[model samples]
Target chain A: MYGKKVKLRIFFFSIIFLAILLTTFLILKSLEENVVYFISPSDVKVLPELSKKKIRIGGMVKKDSIETNAKEILFIITDYKSEIKVSFSGSIPNLFAEEKGVVAEGFLKDRNYFTAKKILAKHDENYMPPEVKKALESKK
Target chain B: MFNIFSPSKIFSITSRATKYVFAIFILIISVGLIEALFLSPKDYIQSDSVRIMYVHVPAAWISLGIFSLIALLSISILIFKNKTFSLIAKSLAPSGFIFSIIALVTGSIWGKPTWGTWWAWDARITSMLILGLFYLMYIVAWRVISPNNANKVTSIIAIIGVVNIPVIKFSVDWWSTLHQPSSINILSKSTIHHSMLVPLIIMTAAFALFSLLIFLMKYNTELIKIKNKGLDRL
Candidate 1:
């Protein structure tokens, strides 16, 4: 009976192990199942016949060329190699300035501007304190 | 055989000391975070989000460090059948899992402000998630296997599974993704000033010590279980 009890204890723990693994799987699948991988115009060298899948493009806002309409805001991003125009319909970030490194996610409707659902700013590697960050913000 | 204060007691003595160590660690972490967040000088550009570095970088560092320690603990058990080593591995698993959780949560919080979206399937995050899952499995392995065989089986798994850690680190560079490479690892071009790096280093050290303290406490509990088993046999 003692041996049996020990074995029973181990069996119960095995179920716990399965439960944690299942939880991890559910969480990761939820995170990845929806994200669309897009590419930049300069990086979009292949220009594959991608018509069905959604994608994202990343680069910089071309200098002094941001155009805004009531419907959309359009700008070009460059990887220092080539540039691609991106049209975003959402509230653009203040840091989404001209000639800074950026990454945007969305689908391309034409060769002109890729419609962006999301835009990300790639700053320097380190985090700055708020006062210094405010200084930079004030300059902008 | 159970000499409470024998030479074997060094391990036990250190286990008790971990509580003091961890308390001091928490103090250091809070001081470091406070300095970095409110008191320290800010960046030339990024304002508030720059403060995310205090939390994000340390959590990320701990996630990987825990796994490497697990591998080391596992190897010591498998190769030498070291009893204390297995105890250490079992205790380390939950903390590693916690650190991974911290890294993911802090990263997501940082992401919302900088990336516009709350989440991204970037290379580094993906690998970090995988590392977290691996940690869960390692802990589960410890719980399921027989105490005797758990040591052997988990040790083997830890040694074999370590291959994934490096793969997770380099996956960003290998595959094009939104996540960038090691910030400090890059030359002085991307270097953070000493003022910023000091707080980060202190936080990292504090976190490591804190994890070790928890590990010692956990080990003491498991040692009790082992001692009880011997009593049962008698």
Candidate 2:
């Protein structure tokens, strides 16, 4: 049998642990919308109504979907389920390229159109040498 | 086992161990640096920029590991009323705080070139920043609170802080963060190539040894303080 002191300590520890767990859960749940860094094209497409507030759209740069002129750059971001057109007049990260992951931040003009004030690149977790990458591509 | 926790005994053992830990730490860290900086292959996409992973990832892992350790020790102190455990936790915290800062700074530096931003309020990043704050608070609690009450106060802070560790680990999965999902998976195959993984593992071991060295030095000093106060037992 456990001593009275041990029982009391265990009860106290459990109470504190559970209280912290519940509080963290509620806090994270309340901040769910904000914690999501960006929404995909599919999620944006199904929005009940469009607002003037700025939002970010994240996906891959649809292969060969880029068009550039002296003034602005145009590209399509696709999540494989849906696609959105993005236009930006700012400098892009070095990692931004066709068939690479990207996130664009700005306002939504329509379900299909996005005007981006900033373009941030996203990369996958894979790491290898350039030669190994080339060899993998050649094998494919 | 109880005798080992005596201040005089721990002081003598740690003083001897510190020298060996330092020598091994220097040797391993030198090897780790060479492997991470020169021997490892560059990323196919990010190229040389990926080298920053050598420092950033290990610092993050160490900080998280150390915080978890401190929490466990705090729990032990609460249940057992062990002053030795409290002293150990106190000594371990500063290195954990330093490593968390290192992780945040290195991550921010890496983000600028790769993510196109210096900072983002994404789930993973925000949780990591909160972790750094928690470490700061824990260290400050030790200093601000009176010695008689410092143990109870710091233990509560540490236990509460541990809730964030799981959140930090799962943030990438739970939300759409700018940070990528972890490449090192214990339950599955890792995505990183062996060449890069080798250097990462070595660097992690080296960092762990360095933290141990720091912990020993801090702990020995605390023990010496107790000895000077003419206490044989903590």
Candidate 3:
């Protein structure tokens, strides 16, 4: 059993704790735009002006839209509603493939074309063996 | 209720229990390693590199879980003014810090193979880095401050640090991070298959036991210090 002093202390601490939590929440909420790591192609579509500054465009690698050469690789990133053509000279990640998620960091040349300085693959949370994945694919 | 948590009683009980905990930890970890390394199904995409998830996920979970526990204990310390609670919180910190480091390092390694980079300034990863820094600050507070001041200072540090826990948990959901969203959900069906989930659960249990072992050892040392100082109560 707690004494009166302890109960008062508990109440006081809870108030302080809640205050701190609220302050943190507000700070993070205000900085929401800065915290977003990348923007999707759908987001890029409505951009009023194209800038030279580097930006990251993230979306799925469009199915059957990748073309490769010894000097560079070209791929179309699509968020279903919109698509951006990305040209990258750098090495692509192993996970980069058709219909898989990818993020390209570079400059947007126009509304439709992006020149990428780097490519990073993004994989989904799903995990399964090759055989099971094959079975799922077949069923689909 | 407080009588059962007296330093001498806890020290003796923990000292006796340590061996059994260690044995269980070793047994569980051995099986966990085998299951995680060999038995678990490889990812359809990432393949064997997905095995890193066994270590990375468990370490992150334990670090997050321990920080939350310490924060709760910190609140108890403030409310009850109990030395035992402070001791438990203090003893719990080192493992939390260690596991946070392990999580960060393992995540980096896992990231390189899968995400194609060792590091990213993404929201989820950045928030996790902040959590690790908070753990560092909490440990430093204990070492730098005097005993009487340490309890209050460390408790405040923990209480403040705990606000980041939810930030880390929800960062992926809230932001357009390079990291994928969570697969394991409590309220709904998990995306991860059963074969992988079983090993993950086993590894998490093993990691929990290992942290418990570390806590008991540290707690016992603190109790011995109290005894050596000739203080009968904590």
Taken over the whole model, the C-alpha lDDT of each candidate is 0.70, 0.92, 0.92
Per-residue lDDT for A1-140 in model 3, tens only?
77899989988998998999899989988998779999999889887778788999999999999999988999999999999999999878899999999999999999899999999999897888888899998999
Off by over 4 Å in 1: A1-38, A126-140, B1-7, B186-190, B231-234
DockQ, candidate 2, vs. native dimer = 0.87
DockQ of each: 0.18, 0.87, 0.86
Pitting candidate 2 against candidate 3, the one with the higher TM-score is 2
Task: Sort all candidates by lDDT, best to worst.
Answer: 2, 3, 1
| Model 1 Cα RMSD, 1 decimal | 8.1
The CAPRI classification for model 2 reads as high
- Score chain B of each candidate by TM-score: 0.87, 0.98, 0.98
Give the CA lDDT, 0 to 100, for residue A134 in model 2.
94
User: Least lDDT summed over 10 consecutive residues: which range in candidate 1 chain A?
Assistant: A31-40
TM-score order, best first, reads 2, 3, 1
Q: Cα miss at B130, model 2 (Å)?
A: 0.8
- Tens digit of lDDT per residue, candidate 1, span B147-214? 65788788666655565676567665555566655667754464576668887888788778878788
Task: Please say which candidate is ahead in TM-score: 1 or 3.
Answer: 3
